[model samples]
Target: MDFRTQTSSLDALSGVNADALVLVLAGDTLPVGLDASVAAAAKDAIKLGDFELKAGKTLVLPRVAGLKAPRLVLACAGKASLKSARSAVQSALSALKSGGTVHAALAFAGFDSLSEALVEQTVLAALEVSYVYRHTKPSAPAAPKLAKLSLLLGKDDAKAAKAGLARGQAIGAGIELAREAANRPPNYATPTFLAEQVKALGKSHGLKVEVLDQKAVEKLGMGSFLAVAKGSTEPLRFIVARYEGAAKTVAPVVLVGKGITFDSGGISLKPGAGMDEMKFDMGGAASVLGTLRAVAELKPKLNLVAIIAACENMPAGNAVKPGDVVTSMSGQTIEILNTDAEGRLILCDALSYAERFKPAVVVDVATLTGACVIALGGVRSGMYASDDELAGALLAAGDAALDPCWRMPLDDEYEEGLKSNFADVANVAGREGGSITAAKFLQRFASKYRWAHLDIAGTAWKSGGAKGGTGRPVGLLTHFLLSQVR
Candidate 1:
């Protein structure tokens, strides 16, 4: 979709040329700047009980006497806030989805402040609602015809609006990329396919990309990562991608992603029901690629590296079983107590590999544990960071991007559950604080650098009717990277 800023006075709004005109409202009261005729029409609608000032509520007026557009949409935001603004945009777009509306001009009627955040959220909401996963399902309805979105802002807010629009568009594209990759069926989106996708991204963005096959990973002594791949015929791929916008002397921020392309729980098989959703186990890898695409587009003056341990975990005759022991890239041994707990296994090796970058900070993203979904639900991703400053930056970035994360404790006590009699540590800990224990396991491999772990099991993808990848933490990660720009 195309996004642009338009400066128009309230009196001139009726003359703005577009297929639809969207006005965001805070209450029943009409905005002060609306043209006399437009204000009268809006007031009459409210007086007649046709519209309510509730968040996410929307009403459409068609071909009003003085309006140039064929339709007028009143999107109730309730108040001037980012969340409300996003709802208002989504509601407005939803109202116009069926219509042949090709372009829309969105205006904030009673919003007291027209900030960059408001514009950014508007773009994101529109793109999100506009997205349709048609790759596998050919019969799925095509996305809406809405192609252009104009944010009607005051002249003073134009600069901020432009910046926000650019950022929003970049992030939206990245999100779509992540979602598409994650939504693909495991057959089509195997570890090799993911490596190919990253290679294509590197080619398009002029980044350095490397794909290490099973032999190379074996040579690197990523026994923990290989253990998860041994069950599947699909060869494991260790992907390392570098985006260098800074000099080589600058230490980069490394992102490690758990890329279990299709996790069937291996020998510790999961229940048959809903096992198909395990295709989304690569959500972290997808989000890492998504963030890399966004960063490449923004061209931030900072170096970034992505490490993905891509493979599949299926129950086979040779699959690693409970009580099996394997050494990681860091030379730490792990006891595989539960093959279902495979995300952490691959991530530990990838995190260990990240040390090669001599990174300023390393943040590993993974759909690691179901306990996180029970703890934080889908509202927030679980975050565990050893460094307070890095934790604070990520928290602030999540807030700014509206991809929120709640910091979880990294207390030493959590590590106790991971102790193993046969190995240095156990891959599976007791059920208590499962998410934190997973983070603690990864933390062991990341001791050489400032590190944080994002457990995105709950937030990466929705289930049931809305089942698909969410492209989460990409916004948070992108914002965090941009914040670190020198």
Candidate 2:
């Protein structure tokens, strides 16, 4: 859909006519003067007692003689929240479906410090409907799509609003990319498919793409990552995409994603029930790629590197058994106690490889543990940062993006769970502090850089009814990158 910015006067909206004009007011009342035509139409609706403006109240009314539009949508939802605002926007979009063009006006002055949030969330909410995932079973019936979106100003200037709209659009596009990758079936989105997707993304955005084969990965001694790939017939790929907008001297931020394309727990197989959802085991990898997609579009003056260890973890004779010990690129040996806990194994080597860049920071996103799903649930991703300052920065970015994250402790005591008798560390680290210990395992190889771990097990996707990748942490990760460059 086309999105544009315009000033908040009747003259500005006079030349253009929309199917529906969505006017958002503050609290339970209309503002003193919301565009002359809009105000007159709303006043008529109020007089008829058909629509009383109040908190969370929404109404669709016929446009009066003075208004240029055929219909008017009054959303009395306050600018207090992204969720509520999105609901209001969905209503406006639904109202405008009968017509081609849609116009939206929100009271920016109504929000105090949340002006930017209100603008960004509203735009994001409108764009959220743009991603229509289709299936063989009729394609969710196809919602009527709008041709253009005109954002109207209420009681604030146009500059900041325009900036927020651009930011939201870029982030939204990135989320769309992530969701598509995560939603695809395992057969269609294998390690090879992921490598191809990264190359396509790089070609479109001027990024340098490199795909390392199993032989190449073995040469680098990524034994831990290769253990999982050995069982799958589909070829393994260690994909790296670099965005070098900054100078060579600057240390780039490195993001590592666990891209186990379809994890079947290898030798320690998972339950047969709900195995189809394992397609999203690569959600972490998808998120990093998604974030890069946005970064490419936004073009920040910061160097970024995405390391994706793409492969499938299947149970076969060649699969690493529970007793197997593998040497990582860092020369650390890990005892594979439970093959289900494979994300950390791949990420450990990737983290060790990140040191070559002398990175400013290294963050790994993974669907690491079910323990994290129990701790944080579906709302937030579990975060474990090496330093408090880095954690604080990520938290702020997550908050701004509305993709919230909760920080978990990275105490030295958790390392005890990962102690191995035959190797340097054990992959599972027991069931007690599973999530924390998993982070501790990855931390062993990332001591050279300011590192952070995001366990996106719960937030990456949904189960049951919604059953698709939520396109999470892409928002959080993208916002964090933008914050650093800004």
Candidate 3:
């Protein structure tokens, strides 16, 4: 474990021995106390303008004559907001590619305005940059190892800081899990394979895990979820992992994930171009499992249940046709107007299943629409919620975690396009309000409780050279759960 927490005074910090001592310089704000002294010591460098500490800037200084550490990283924290401060530190950590051990005093001068949440965000962002995702290459490439990352905290806020550090590490581990799963190829990451992995993970983590088979799904009348699975040789898999950290009576927060391990659009085959990227279809399920992984370590005083509807959408003789209609577990008949629009079919069933728990809230994550990627680009997730307070809480959580979401219209007007001549609702609402229509479809099944939908298509994974799962929303989900506990 390279992550550790320590508290040191501004005066004592100068004498401590470590690789790099990170300091933050807020926008146009003069350094004070230890910060001022550190600057004064490096006055020549500051005066000569050897380094700049503008917002989101990073400058590395080595061989300081008087400083105990050989390196000093000055990160610019504009306005000292959590987002800006986190990015500043993130840039510095990324620059230290050959990481050994670094002593970070990121909250050094912002003590009065700095809270534990801010410290936590900084630590997690640092850890995030340091993470190296690998795959089944011929051999593991040698990479820089971050042996240790110690956070320098204020004496008064030491306790909260320690808590934040722990939270950061746990969430980081969870995110790594999500990224790993999403990065795997479709052939290697089948529906049954994912369920088996989740079952094994629960055993290791001491969580209550149950994998429901196709028979179980048939018994529940989940035709909509199963229709998508019929094309692939892989069996349908649904995972329900429960973490009861609070009292038995407490209603748990339910998270439903779309797990179409590989989507070939079934009989509605998509164009061959970029089809390999379908491996990332299960990003939503990976995130749910990732959040549970963190919760297992954090052990907060809140009960939670994570549900994944796992399957594959492939073109085959048995594949469901575009004109077919299937009934969901909720007895709602859905017209399969387009085979490519399958994420919502799986999520709707899981949402209906969540009603069994009488959850306090329900949120389903899915890479449901290409429209989301077009709308939000690669920056933020698209969110839709009927309840204003739930939507607002999620927005606040995203802000705190740096995994932001923009609320799109969940207006009833969009549902009209889903009108089907043959069924209760069409699986898709043409291409107009695609993302919002997808969210609206899932909303019908989750009306039993306060609910939110996260359309993570844009934010889940990057394309091109950095192509891989981003492990989004895990940080957002973890932060939101912790808030509920408080």
Worst 10 residues of 2 by lDDT: 105-114
lDDT of 3: 0.83
Task: For residues 255-332, write the lDDT of model 1, one tens digit per residue.
Answer: 888899999999888999999999999999999999999999999999999988899999999999999999998888
Query: What C-alpha lDDT, on a 0 to 100 scale, does residue 295 get in candidate 3?
Result: 91
TM-score of each: 0.98, 0.92, 0.94
Stretches of candidate 1 exceeding 4 Å from the true structure: none
Q: After superposition, how far is residue 176 of candidate 1 from its true place, in Å?
A: 0.2
- What would the per-residue lDDT of candidate 2 be over residues 296-356, giving only the tens digit for each residue? 9889899999999999999887788998999999999989999988999899989998999
- RMSD per candidate (Å) reads 1.0, 2.7, 2.2
lDDT of 3 by residue, 77-173 (tens): 7776777777777877776766554444343565355476776787677767766766676565555554566777666776777777788788888
Q: In angstroms, how far off is 212's CA in candidate 3?
A: 1.1
- lDDT score for residue 378 of model 1: 97
The parts of candidate 3 lying over 4 Å away from their true place are 35-37, 99-107, 110-114, 138-141
Query: Which structure among the candidates has the greatest lDDT?
Result: 1
